[model samples]
Target: MTMDGALARIIRSAADRAAAAEPEVCDLCAAPVAEEHPHLYDTGAAEVRCVCRPCSVLFAEDGAGEGRHLLVPRRRLRLPPVDTAVLGVPVGLVFFVPRSDGTVTAQGPSPAGAMRWEVDASAWQRLTATFPQLASMAPEVEALLVNTARGPRAHWIVPIDDCFRMVALVRREWRGLSGGGRVWPAVERFFAELTERP
Candidate 1:
């Protein structure tokens, strides 16, 4: 099959698997959740929690809970023109999550786990200059996800939890040295879904 056809098939298969899985519950309230739900980033714990609507709203403000819990925004922005090489990630895919300390953590998914590295401040400044949206990403709750595998490089400002979800997907599906035969297409599908999201 062609690459696009194969990616569509893989996405369908993944969705089928999701449909067959048991429902999830709110991490804080224990309320049942749909297959898709809002998330909250626990800044203190550096983790994302699946939360019910009420709990999600409670932390919607950036300062809510004294910077403890920040609601992950649903906004997904297509980044303006930029060069991926400046980011300096060895992998073609990487995500940048802002830290409270005025720095960003650059990470990518790999067979081993989420591999992280320090981002060069000058390079980051260049990117933010080109795409000002990067500077406004909700601290500790959103991230910039970049995919540079092929074609025109794409970047998306997405929720921090989404980045972690991508990392988990990679860790779960990766095989062999070059991510085996199936992992790349799965990653493609992951980004495809993000692009198609409203």
Candidate 2:
């Protein structure tokens, strides 16, 4: 079967199982999955799917599935200095990812939910020039997550799933206008863990 076809089947199977409230399984093989497992982003669906290590390895090449499915890379880097003020996000944290339509999307966690806005193309180009690493981001699958909420502002190139997960975290923990008392600490711990990962 074509790779995309196989991936679609796996995603469908996993979704069916999830609907039944069963344990999470590999989207490709239906094997039981660990609490923490590799994921791929479906560009068409704008969703992340859990897959077995074997399946993940299949798509690990620099470009896989011809843009249908993108294996989320584990590489994380500390971004070079760049101005966040230009993005105009009210929140201290925001993530930028490229869309299939050639536009850049800027999103961040908010008390209501994930907030999104279209980033100007010229501005995006400037960012890529300033931080050359931005040029390597896998379109539609990887994101540049920036956290300026606390001391030592940080930037990371993370999977799109990770950015959405952080959005969920903020939505769940946010309180009042300032994001409750626990939100910042939780965010710190999350980044700390990421930094510790090998």
Candidate 3:
């Protein structure tokens, strides 16, 4: 083949490779999964895993692998506004993760990611007591996602992955210093879509 033809062939091959989507495999079982798949929160690793149905079902009710892996729930809840002064989260968007020790960690999304913030243990307990729904959240795998970025603040009991998605959104949209104006609307849209999800 001529030199020009060889270059064209190489370029075409590269394009073909780029167009081929990589198969998403289950982290637990290594099975190929669909675009939208169940995810599990590996407590042992403190990370999330994209998994197939069967592998996720193993921890559906939680407490599988000696409580090492917990299935992330799909439950979504829109909670009424409540007093959160106790938690003292500095940011407008926060996600609270429950611990096995009966304490909840107050965290907020930033350009960095989901960041843990300090809260009074007694006050957190009181807040949870005031809201039984908060107390009942599935430990480790679910989070109370609170959004106060815009007026008429909203609160939702969201999946842990949803919280991570919000973290990712903020990380992606954030600009230098004051987190550019675009970030808030994007944050709003994120919650709006979550609200619309069935």
Candidate 4:
């Protein structure tokens, strides 16, 4: 066969292999799903979809789906907290976001907007290394939340959506490093919240 024909055959074969790999039921509709299917995130309705390409592309345009729907980013960012040798954050737990504007924004989130702060590379390194997953965090959607309250506690693998909750809890309830009584309760509550999620 000619080169163009060979390439077309190869593409078709790949598509066939993918089709052979799907589960029987559609994850969303429970209608029978073929192995070859597209995945979509409904930004307007906040839904995940296992759809045919036509349905997946329906919402592909900018500001589609009433502007509420956002595709669930398929890519995962691995961001670990970097070390902070300078201006050690008074509290151990802090969330750091490296913004698109080339600014490293740090905060713990409070009732107010993110109680903004910044840290140098050393501190960032210390925190990120402990939580390697933070290194690949998606901008605006996630952050590296680090806890060094009493010499570095275990890092929590949390969703970007949940970082604000951590900040609000820390700001409102934290009294001291032991997080005082108020802080511990909030931490427990946050922990419980994580456990309940799938």
Candidate 5:
């Protein structure tokens, strides 16, 4: 093939790859983005947004109206001795995150967030009995995940991403009643690793 034709083909191929690798445009502003992009919190809409770097950092500046949508924090904390009653969570395996709004988001066999299976009274009681430190979780962004199998452990205040990952595990891997064998084992392994964190 001619050098000019070859170069033209290569450029087209590169353009196609770039397009495929890019993320969908922001729902609010219609901006283009690369696959991995920063998020924007829209307080007026109470929604999370995928934004270009410029827009994302612009919102991060928190000028007047911009300050309303607080950035989701990235820090993780391993807290000790959380109060269980405040959470009213009854399951040993559960997680909760307080949103900017007063209510909390929870998951698992407990009080709040999203759950794959219902938690009975006994399950709730068993969980709260073992982990009391989860009560101290800061509302919004901070979450408490209790592993009853871990046995009377302190709370680990981690970024909300960690809780979401646990939810993904259960929803994706859990099978019939008791989440079958695979999910429970995976949950245990996750807790074991988290507890070992410094």
Candidate 6:
């Protein structure tokens, strides 16, 4: 092939690679966003969206844009140990997701998927009264993540997306009926890193 044709082919290949490797852009304004950038939760449809800094700012407040766009906060608070027994569930890793209707749902990871466990209302009331922080959790966008795989007291108040991410990780790494060995270590590492987040 001619030198010009060969050079053009090389340029095209390089461009293709660059395009393929492009970073994820904000869904709102199409601005380039980093891997660790902010995210938005569409409450109306229960969807998570990647967003840039400015778009996040625009919808930082609750009920922004007719209550459709809710900015996901970056708060990662280490909470005191909670009693899983009181919640009517076995001692294990679980997360509490609050709905807008003033009800909270308890869910945990399993080989099949996220499994819901029945919770006692009186027990939930007692726990929430003990921790006032639980009362302030963002509705539909934040969750109380309790990691008891190691032991009790490994609780955190994290973004709602983190809950889904944890569910995904467990479902992905889980193996056979026993859950194999890798799942526990990954869970430990995840909580460790989560605790260390700024």
Q: For candidate 2, lDDT tens digit of each residue in 1-198?
A: 999999999999989978998977887888988887899888778778899888898888866778788888766777665686776657678899987677888997888877889988888888788878888887788788888878567888887878878888888888888877989988887777665132
The local distance difference test score of each candidate is: 0.81, 0.81, 0.81, 0.55, 0.58, 0.81
**Against the hidden reference, what TM-scores do the models get?**
0.82, 0.79, 0.84, 0.45, 0.54, 0.80
Q: Over all chains combined, what TM-score does candidate 5 have? A: 0.54
Which residue pairs in candidate 2 collide? none
Prediction 6 TM-score vs. true: 0.80
Cα lDDT of model 5 by residue, 1-198, tens digit: 999999999999889979887557865478877776655555566445666776665555436234555444445566565555545555667666555444555566422335643234444345446655444444444566556544456456665556766776777776765567677677677666764332
| Alpha-carbon RMSD, candidate 5 | 10.6
Q: Write the per-residue lDDT of candidate 1 for residues 94-191, one digit (tens) a residue.
A: 88887777787888888887889988877887888887888888777788898887545678989888898898999988888888878878888888
RMSD, each candidate, Å?
9.3, 7.1, 6.8, 17.3, 10.6, 8.0
Q: Which stretches of candidate 4 lie over 4 Å from their true place?
A: 1-88, 109-113, 121-132, 150-152, 171-180, 192-198
Task: Highest TM-score: give the candidate number.
Answer: 3
**Could you tell me which 10 consecutive residues in candidate 4 have the lowest summed lDDT?**
70-79
**Local distance difference test, candidate 2:** 0.81
Clashes of each: 0, 0, 0, 35, 11, 1
Worst 10 residues of 6 by lDDT: 146-155
Clashing pairs for predicted structure model 6, backbone only: 81-153
TM-score order, best first, reads 3, 1, 6, 2, 5, 4
